[model samples]
Target: MSLKSLIQGQKPLTISIISFLLMLALVIVIGLFGGRHIIGYLEGQLVAHGIDHNQEVIAGMQPILERGLQDGAAVSVIVSNFQSFIEHAEPFGIRLFLVDRKAGRVLADSQNRAAFPYPLNQLLDSMPRQLNGAPIHDLANWDGNAWRRTASGSVELISLHDLVVPANREERWALGVSSDLSELLVLMDSLHLHLDVVLLITYGLIGLLGFLVLRWVGRRYEAGLEQQVAERTRELEQAQERLIDQARLATIGQTASVLAHEMRNPLASIKLALSGVSRSEGLADREKQRVDLVLGEVDRLEGMLSQTLDYVRPVVRDEQPVVLDDLLDKVLGLEEELLSEKKLRLVRSKCPQCPPLRMDREKMQQVLLNLLKNAQEASPDGGEIQVSLEADDKKLVLTITNQGPAPAQEVLDRACDFFFTTKARGTGLGLGLVKRVVEEHGGSVQLGSASGKVLVTIVLPTAD
Candidate 1:
């Protein structure tokens, strides 16, 4: 079909599918990046809290040390005060181990030492070396199994600190204090659970939304497919009807051929007899000219008969490659005189690089001529006819258009069938012949009205 006709008849499914896929892709991309952001934020919060809690524990020990150094209080007394401070500080599990600078003794404990015991050397050796002279701490390294009865059931952080006392001007005794972090571990667990639940719900909603959207898309796609199939089926039926009409025309043409053959000899003999009588009888010049006009009418009728027969004969499909631009130029050459006689203006354009198609050159020419003639007839004096060729990677398309009133639906429907016409003296086989020739070339012919113009298009497969 022609470019304008094909564009006007396009379905909306392709555009709809592209829009839906873009929406889905956008959501997927957002979810991927958003998930990364969420995970990064959670990890950052955990690390920040770990540092904060460790700092709080170390800072709490400063008051106890000030009393021992400035007031010259006993180490044992400072240790007892520090123990009382931890027991009431917060609900979090806290351990305090105050040992001498030699790391040999525990002065105070958060867990009841009577119930659970801790090995001093084992704890000190495990301290992280990166701690800048302060004791090491880790949230994941706490052990509750040693004091199962007193231990809260959770993974936790453990903080350790050593109490330093001056033994001389340069040396001091080192003591240890450790804090248990079962409560923060519990908070972390709760935060993780909340995040997981939110993620699950969000993903579920997204999945449900995607399913509904796809279902809606699927329904729309099916409806469009059905509509397209119905439309194509109707066109196929129309094509079949045209084929049947061509068969009938072939039948009529055969009959007319026989009748013409029988009448031509008698008509020629009568013309010769009339001429002889006019020459012998004192006929005036005007009377002789009138006799000659009668002969001309007979010849015109004979020519019309021959044209009708040619229309009925099925077009021979030519399989050779044809350059469509050259073919269009050839058709234009044949119709130039006719166009000039009608005073119709013709405008032509071609793509920069049009592909060749395998088609019958004669048939294509005939189709173009028939469409151009229709355009010329439809338009008023000095009306314009436009012709163009457009090619893509796979198909070559031709269009011919003329400004005119739209044809009635009934006329448009039957215009490409044999022997259908609206003109007073038209033979009415023009469009039918065009249809036969186009189909024989394995292309399609289409006709339509748009924007106060009538358009005809031909589409042929190309080798690209």
Candidate 2:
């Protein structure tokens, strides 16, 4: 795969790994440089210790040599005394040498005369001229078997050269001491090894822990994204179903509009013929009653056709302030005959505090008539229908309820759905039309079965 694609595909895991690798690299670099710095510091301390040891040696031997010289001891006697002192003194892998400046020869050796490789004249000639009253020190690496008895079978040697002048003497002496650094070097190597092991273990553990944490977080994030995708898919499916339902409703509305228009002329012709038959002198009383019944059915069909047309058409509202009690009284007056025919009692309850509402007068009247008609039709013989109006905050609430067989819960839920009905002769446009009108007036409608009755509540905004 291309580098960019690979990086993007596994972005989180890749980023975590890259970060961890960088940290590990940083740690490794710091360990290396820090280790070298520590080693250098230790080596410096060893060098300082060697210088101190050389000074101590010089201080101890100087007084003894001066005493021998003041007693007029011979040169051989002084050399013998120095050798005896060296034999009795502590040996910390250090060897001392004495040299005569005038004779250009080694006077005495701490290890052995054979251990001195170069003559005193050659050593003095090679050294710097200025002493500055301080010993000269040098570091040398020795690879010979002469240091086989030492710690590592090889040695780092520190050499110090000091100039000594005796009282009443024209000759000067050179005192040299050499110390081995093999043991210190061994300790430094062990320290470095241990540091490397610890650092490696620490980095390994940290990298492992980081990897596990990243894996866990990645899994959780992936699961969350998957859940979101599933939820989105479900929402899309529901939206698609709604779109299908709307398409079906649109087709039904178009067909109903055309059919209602086509039936109107024929229905009018039939009604005219039925009216002429009822007025004829030759018709018997029974025939006339039958004709009147047919005329009533024709009128009912016309009303249904008109309602279908209204359902299909858009509403045009001319809004104005309307008093709640006055509007209810008008609708009830229109429904008076139907209520009497069904033997249903009307009970009106008006809250004195009810307020005027802003609505289209014609549309609001139609909504109240439809609701009252539904309550009349659903009520049993001598059943009471209750109509109540009250003001709630900034709105007017109206409720119409009747004692009747309660509608099924499912039917009540879809009571406002277009063309949905439980009644055999229902056009199914009454409640739907009421809902449309109320909504157009910035109001809401709800239907429910409660307390052994079907209740419909309408809320409309009050005028300021």
Candidate 3:
């Protein structure tokens, strides 16, 4: 798969784990480079310190040569004197030798053996060291040493040292020291292997710790995203419900419009005949009372038709700048008679800085009156009815709360739906009209119950 597809197919946790592993891999690579650098430096320091032993052998032999050369002793005498020193060092795996530049020979080795034509770097020189005053400019203290493998496949060290003998001598000599390093080499190999193991274990432990932390981060990230998706899903469901409600109401409005049109003319004729009969002189008192009752029922039917028609009608706005507090007080004054009949108390609160709003004045009054009427119906006898008006940057919020039995959850959910009501005689269009008007003016309605009180909240946009 392509890299993008590969990443898309993985869960957040797996992706995070892989990413952390890559980071850990990079860290391991850096550690490997650093470890090797440290080991190389350590090995150099150890070998250089070990090579100091080679110089010690040369220093010990210097004095014996100095004494013999100052006495004008033969080269054979110097060679014979090296026997005791070489024998003492034999147990330590040391090989001591001397190379005489004048004769092109190994004068004597640690084993008291001499070999002519020594094929080493120090022993052979083209220029004569005698009879020509040959310059002996080779170092007078010590030369550097190196690791070398012998013909027998054993590792050894070849350390060379320069000699300072009696002046005016017709010979130049260099000291040679060799030692077996197989045991030290084996120890160093083991140490390097141990270091590699330590690095591997340390990296494993660090990677495990990083993996756990990344897992936690991935979980939180996944949970947050899931919550957002759930919320969006709820919003979509709510929108679907709204569309369904609108479609149902549209179908109902069309049927009501037809029925109301047919019923109005027949009701008008019945009311005219009843009025004419009630004014007749021959009409009895009992007959007149029954006729009045019939007329009253007819009027009620007509009023119901008007209400239905009102709900069916679309809102036609008359935009104006209306003082919100004044309009509110006027509506409340009109409803004072109803409030008094039930002995219900109306408590009013408004923010001081709530500015004048641009909206349909008649519609605003209708919205407020419908809500007040609902509150009055829900409030217990002599219970408190609270109305509050608050404002913020972009909207005006109005809340109406009554001390009434809280409605059921289902009721609250469908309270604004057309023909949805809880009252016995309710036509269910009052709050429905209120909702339509408020929404038409760019607002929303919220119904809730809190502390056994029925609360209706309206949020109206302040923008023109």
RMSD of each: 13.4, 9.1, 8.3
Candidate 2 lDDT by residue in tens digits, 1-464: 89888778886767877877887787777777777788778777876776677667877777777777677778778888777776644376777767765565667776664543345544331222111223232212111111112333645343344455556776566566656667787887898788677777776677677777777887998999999999999999978965865675577688777777788889899999999999999999999999999999999998987787666555565555678799889989988998899888888898777766665677678788888888887899999999999888888889899998998888888888777888888878888888777876778898898789988999888753
Residue pairs whose backbone atoms clash in candidate 3: none
Worst 10 residues of 2 by lDDT: 139-148
**Deviation (Å) of 302 in candidate 1:** 2.4
Candidate with maximal lDDT: 3
Provide the TM-score for each candidate, comma-separated: 0.46, 0.55, 0.65
Candidates 2 and 3 compared: the better one by TM-score is: 3
Tens digits of lDDT, candidate 1, 1-464: 89768655766556455555666566656665676577667655764565566557666775667556666776556666767776664465555554443434344556544422233443433433332334435312332112111233433344444444445423243333344445655665676666656665676577668767776888888999999999999999988976777678768888778867887788778877876866766888888888888877777777667667767666655666778888778888988998898788999998769867666676677777778778888988888999999985577788899988999878888898677899887777789778777766677788888899888888877742
Q: Model 2 off-target regions past 4 Å? A: 1-253, 319-326, 340-360, 388-398, 435-445, 457-464
Taken over the whole model, the C-alpha lDDT of each candidate is 0.66, 0.73, 0.77
The worst-scoring run of ten residues by lDDT in candidate 1 lies at 142-151
Residue 274 miss distance in model 1 (angstroms):
7.6
Top candidate on TM-score is 3
Q: What number of backbone clashes does candidate 3 have, counting pairs of residues 3 or more apart or in separate chains?
A: 0
Model 1: what TM-score?
0.46
